[model samples]
Target: MKANPISPTIPLDAEGVHHGHLRLPYSRDDSAWGSVMIPICIVRNGSGPTALLTGGNHGDEYEGPLALFDLARSLDARALSGTVIVVPAMNYPAFRVGTRTSPIDKNNMNRSFPGKSDGTVTQKIADYFHRELLPRADIVLDFHSGGKTLDFLPFCAGHLLPDKAQEAKVFAAVRAFGAPWSMQMTEIDAVGMYDTAAEEMGKVFVTTELGGGGTSRAETVRIARRGVDNLLKHAGILRGAPEILPTRWLEMPDGCFCFAEEDGMIETTVDLGEKVEAGSVVARIWPIGRTGSEPHEIKANISGILVARHFPGLVQSGDCASVVATMAD
Candidate 1:
């Protein structure tokens, strides 16, 4: 297949700000649908390694994209070396509608990696990114947050193996993030995931899950901004002293997946990152009726730290209730 046409690059002032767009094509029948492109603002000084910062891959996760917008507006790239390409809304269609997947394709852009040049809208966008943007990046930081119905504690996800030299860099990036929790993810390949593909290509990449559902959290945004600054310093793109974090890195020797035992309204009694012992009551499920029905108590299976919890109050039978990371003793 012929290479997709490169979008025009718009140059900004000497301060190192510019605007451009990425065009992703769908099918010929929907050619009139035109190219789906996102407005990207690039800022940097002389030619150096490029770092790509993108958000809104999952539309409902609002903070990352908004934070990228703030970074673009406030950054003075003239003082720094290397390029910073900021894509505030990667999934523009979903972002505009405050949804997680493209309304047209109903596909999660994050799951559609190395997309086809002439595939569905989501696939095209993914293909555009893989072909056009990713190859130029020396380091990538993909921002995300929990969707509308779920709340997530701030964390970083990256591969963790004993032998990879890049693992140190990944850990450093996560420590600089200063989030209380960091999850070591094993590499997987499917569609639309930037981290797995970046790893395969041997590029330095990390995915930051910053804050909970919806926007409105200043503290979360501030933390993310600080992380970006620290990463820039670490990369030698910026001249500054990076802040050291008091980080506690935990490994999950065994994970106990908590699934709902009955269909009912679920209520969590424990918070994320909380410690619980085996048989401890972590949640309760009860029928929605006003009349009191016996609430079923959900107990922990192992003594460990609760890493993830279902935020929605409603639960169905077999739905994941929580995940507990336990140390092997």
Candidate 2:
């Protein structure tokens, strides 16, 4: 792969607190040679472990960026034994516009990892993180929530990696985050995700899905903030014990367990954290502008708790309606 053109204003290895930007050149009608400046904060002290914290992968998800912004502003270099690299908005273009994909190229940043330097704008950003940012970390936390299209129960999740040893380490951090729920999940699509890139490099990675609807709640934001602090402490970069909390372990074994089948108005019958049974009606969709038509019911394929649901009142044929999670070992 070719070298990325995105350049950071500060050295990632340098000591002390540095606030800067990841500059990516852009050519537009208004400015022929202007660049998009993605904000970054790095706090470095002596050597222990480098924990990379990132948020705003999708523009509409606000909890990650909000929590990370506060974290970056309040974090002090003198309080750390290692390094804390923070990027509050990974997708600057999309973040600015409050959209799921970049406005410049309409590409999803999370699905564009290990990206090509010569690719589209979004891919270039991903390429830089893949080549430049990710290699400098011992652990990675990429925060996420369902954006405009869906909403989720507050939970921090760890993927089931092929390497059990790595998976164990990641799960420890996930559990340490101490969200209400700790989840072991298998991604429906993991092709070029940043999580996949980090995990593939053997880095311990923990991600989250807080409340969503293209917005955030105060409680979920608090959860995100505390989770970050807990993760830092767990990684030994910060000098403190993690807040102990009893986290309910859950798992999403199959992607087909929750999804919508037709375009209509969705009426969810189950709420997040509510226990559901297999074959139970999770949601029902009313046909668009069709009277006397029976509503189509969406059912839960597996028995567990309803952990996620569609956000908008209306639904497309293929939108995911709800995700049920079962107990995990």
Output the number of the lDDT-best candidate: 2
Q: What tens-digit string does per-residue lDDT give for candidate 1 at 16-86?
A: 77777765544356576576667788887887778888889988887777778888888777667888888
Query: Candidate 1: where is the Cα deviation over 4 Å?
Result: 5-15, 25-35, 161-163, 186-192, 289-293, 326-329
lDDT of 2 by residue, 262-302 (tens): 88999999988999998989999999887999999998898
lDDT of 1 at 212: 60
The per-model lDDT (C-alpha) reads 0.73, 0.92
Question: In model 2, what are the clashing residue pairs, if there are any?
Answer: none
User: TM-score for model 1?
Assistant: 0.86
- Which runs in model 2 stand beyond 4 Å of their true positions? none
